[model samples]
Target: MNSNAIKARKKVLVILTQSPYGNALSREAIDYCLAAAAFEQDLTLLFTGDAVLQLINDQNPSTINQKDLTKTLSALPIYGINQFYVDSNALEQYGIDNDFCVPTIKVDVKEISELLVNADTILNF
Candidate 1:
């Protein structure tokens, strides 16, 4: 099937490596997905590399002039974007876990890259 047709009947995966407050792209990407979910789109979120920082615990962010991404990540379920994922080695390298992040699957870079290629539409933020 073509890309739009695939997406129409399948899930959307968003891979985020950008931080919440350093720039607006990350936040915008998430907000756009929320909007997509609002439209009944099936959505999944994956965190890897530096993006794992988005799930770090208890970030007050005021000191760094950033919004608390943890809050946004925690709200995924309410928005129906609950199929979350994290690279296993990235979690080890970044020191994170399920409790500190959205419900996630353990995936490595190889599988992750494959997921991107296979996805009807892969969005990186």
Candidate 2:
């Protein structure tokens, strides 16, 4: 039997470090995450650096002709990707508080290190 068939599912960590609307990385990350979730894989999403801006609530991307990412991001739990974490330092640097963004746990570098070690696979964008 295949090793994949033997293991139930593997933990996947997705780290987003890109800005939200200027390019396609953010959208691609979401697509990858939803696809992984559809496979019943354990998933964790981490927003670091400028990517955390994607979570900012009450965004009106129509002005820029971009789709509203917050709406899609908030729906992650509905798709079974509930583990969301943000870098506390990034949050502070960006002048964002938890309330300003989609609900997520704020973690420091040490905690991020632990999450990386525990993840079976990591995808960074």
Candidate 3:
């Protein structure tokens, strides 16, 4: 590789569909997002299905001997990862309204489809 070569940044969409704390998938997904952002990748995160639970404020993972994910999520903006989305349908199903630990855009099915179609890469967790 040439030293002067510039790597093209890719539009990466990371979809999280699992519940937090039941296992390590949610944490691993977050780690992947942080790593990709560190490399200057254009990253977007979508929380759908049970993943919507990850966004709720005042999570208490310490009681279960796990690290608090909300704290990690709140630090995403510092890594230039400002594009966070939650499926509107999921929010409705889960009855979540304006209590997210971090700022997130609520995307309808059409917008979610557009996001998937437009991304250069998609990662699901």
Among these predictions, the greatest lDDT belongs to 3
Q: Write model 1 residue lDDT over 41-122, tens digit each, in one string.
A: 8777777777777776777988977777777767767877777677788788866665665666779889888778777777
Q: Which residue pairs collide, candidate 2?
A: none
Every candidate's lDDT = 0.75, 0.86, 0.90
For each candidate, what TM-score against the reference? 0.79, 0.91, 0.92
Q: Is candidate 1 or candidate 3 better by TM-score?
A: 3
Q: For candidate 3, lDDT tens digit of each residue in 39-68?
A: 888898999999999999988988989999
Candidate structures ordered by lDDT, highest first: 3, 2, 1
How well does model 3 score by local distance difference test? 0.90
Q: Check candidate 1 and list the clashing pairs.
A: none
Off by over 4 Å in 2: 1-6
- lDDT string, candidate 2, 1-125, tens digits: 78877876778899999888987999889888878887777999999999988888888999999998877787778887767899999989989876644668989999999999999999998
| Clash counts for the predictions, in order | 0, 0, 0
